[model samples]
Target chain A: DTAVSQTPKYLVTQMGNDKSIKCEQNLGHDTMYWYKQDSKKFLKIMFSYNNKELIINETVPNRFSPKSPDKAHLNLHINSLELGDSAVYFCASSPRTSGRAQETQYFGPGTRLLVL
Target chain B: DQQVKQNSPSLSVQEGRISILNCDYTNSMFDYFLWYKKYPAEGPTFLISISSIKDKNEDGRFTVFLNKSAKHLSLHIVPSQPGDSAVYFCAAPCGGNKLTFGGGTRVLVKP
Candidate 1:
């Protein structure tokens, strides 16, 4: 069984199209996160949610938004996608009991998106 | 500005040898360091981590060394095997629950 999973492992869309990526974790974690690994292979944190509460938002653009319906799932939606948005997006989860900032995070297989 | 940096984009090591990957950070507030290993199509897996209070932490064949004064940390893999070849990322918690990651370093173990 996968500890963390994402739907539509591959997504291809035209520029300006709207798209979404879904994530779920079965590890009973209270914190979830979204990361984008660009062509430079730098995995940058995009957003973080703890128990359905938004806790961290990086310098990402307004076109990207993250939603956490519950502790087990966090979804990312993009509007007016651009060529720069083409990258691998990953979902991660971690227990908040340990210091939320320093605890180990478990990541899901990335969703590779291609924007034409 | 990039807080965490992995200058080496790639590395090559022979089997049964030692592989050392280096990382540097500009943020002094980071008290914890971590390394994540990622295969071609899979997500990153937590490999090892070292707390600021300690200089070193070891698990199995992996060891993480932290030098607070130098603002540097490294991952050492002993007796490197083919299975150990993957992209390794250096990371640290930024302000809250989020982490700042360095550009990954790809390691290839030659048999």
Candidate 2:
């Protein structure tokens, strides 16, 4: 079974449209995160949820909001998607009690989004 | 400014040889560093890591060396195999949790 899984492995939409990407982790992790990898291959953290509560949020646009209904599920919703939203979005999770950052991170296959 | 950087875009090594990849960070608060290997169309996989307290950590053919004072870290692959060919990225966790990743370096292990 996949430790971390994401829906809509590939998504294509036009600007001004709305879309969402869903993610789940089966690893019993308390901390889950969403990252965006731009064309330059820089994976930047957008948001993190700990037990369904937002913990870390970078300077992401207000249109890009993340919602976590439960500990295992985190969904990202983009309003009026822009062309710059085209990139690979990855879902990752790790135990919140981890004392060390060296702990392994479980990542999903990633959802590729394209905005025209 | 970029906090974590992997200046070398690529490195090539013949099979059975040694391959070294370097990374540098500006944040001293980063107590742990990690290396991830990624293939085309797939998410990155954990390779290895080292804590600030340790100077080096090794596993099988892979080793991670961390110099806390210099805020530099490097990954060494001994007996490099073609299967090791992939994009290697170095990352550090800031504020105790959120990870910041480097741009990544492509490694090619020749057969």
Candidate 3:
């Protein structure tokens, strides 16, 4: 069974266009995260949510907005997409978000976005 | 600045050989560490982890070692097979549930 899954595995769009990526996790996790892997292959966390509440928000552009409908779903919406936004976006989740420093995070296959 | 750093960008090893990947961290407060492996067109999967209280943790052919004094961690894959080839990342939780990840080390196990 797929613990985590993201829609639109591959996305190609023109500059200034808007797009959205959807993610879902069926592991009964309480915390979810969104990560971006740039061209340099550096993976960085952009946003995180615990039980459908925003917890972590990195220095991401305002054009990018994340919405968590419930504990199992998180969606990313981008406005006026820029070329630099092209990268692989990954979704991850953990069972709980307390003092469990040793908790394991499950990741999705990733969505490859290309802004032309 | 990047708290976690993986110096080796890539490593190629022969089948049945051993592969070692290293990672360094700037903060000493990081007492827990994790290693993730990612294949092409796929997300990273949890491989192994090590806590500061222990020096080494082993799981089958994968072993992770931690050195608190040097603030370093390493992942060792013994008898690495071709299927073992993937990009490995070392990560540490900064605060709460946020994980600070290293750049990553790509391993190519040749058969």
Clashing pairs in 3: none
Evaluate residue A95 in candidate 2 and report its C-alpha lDDT on the 0 to 100 scale.
Answer: 86
Interface RMSD of 1: 1.1
- Give the DockQ-based CAPRI class for model 2: medium
Kindly list the per-residue Cα lDDT of model 1 for residues A1-116, writing each as its tens digit.
89999988999999999999999999998989999999988898899999999998988999999999889999999999999999999999988775534368999999999999
> How much TM-score does chain B earn in each model?
0.98, 0.96, 0.98
- Among all windows of ten consecutive residues in candidate 1 chain A, which has the lowest summed lDDT? A94-103
Per-model TM-score on C-alpha atoms: 0.96, 0.96, 0.97
**Can you write out model 3's per-residue Cα lDDT over A27-102, one digit (the tens) per residue?**
8998899999999999899999999999999999999999999999999999999999999999999987455533
Clashes of 1: 0
Candidate 1 Cα deviation (angstroms), residue A66 = 1.4
The pairs that clash in candidate 1 are: none
Return whichever of 2 and 3 wins on TM-score.
Answer: 3
Among these predictions, the greatest TM-score belongs to 3
**Which candidate number maximizes DockQ?**
1
Model 2 residue B51 distance off true place after TM-score fit, in angstroms: 0.9
Ranking by TM-score: 3, 1, 2
CAPRI tier for the interface of model 1 = high
> For candidate 2, lDDT tens digit of each residue in B16-83?
99999999999888888889999988888898888888999999999999988888999999989999
lDDT of 1 at A114: 99
Candidate 2 accuracy as TM-score: 0.96
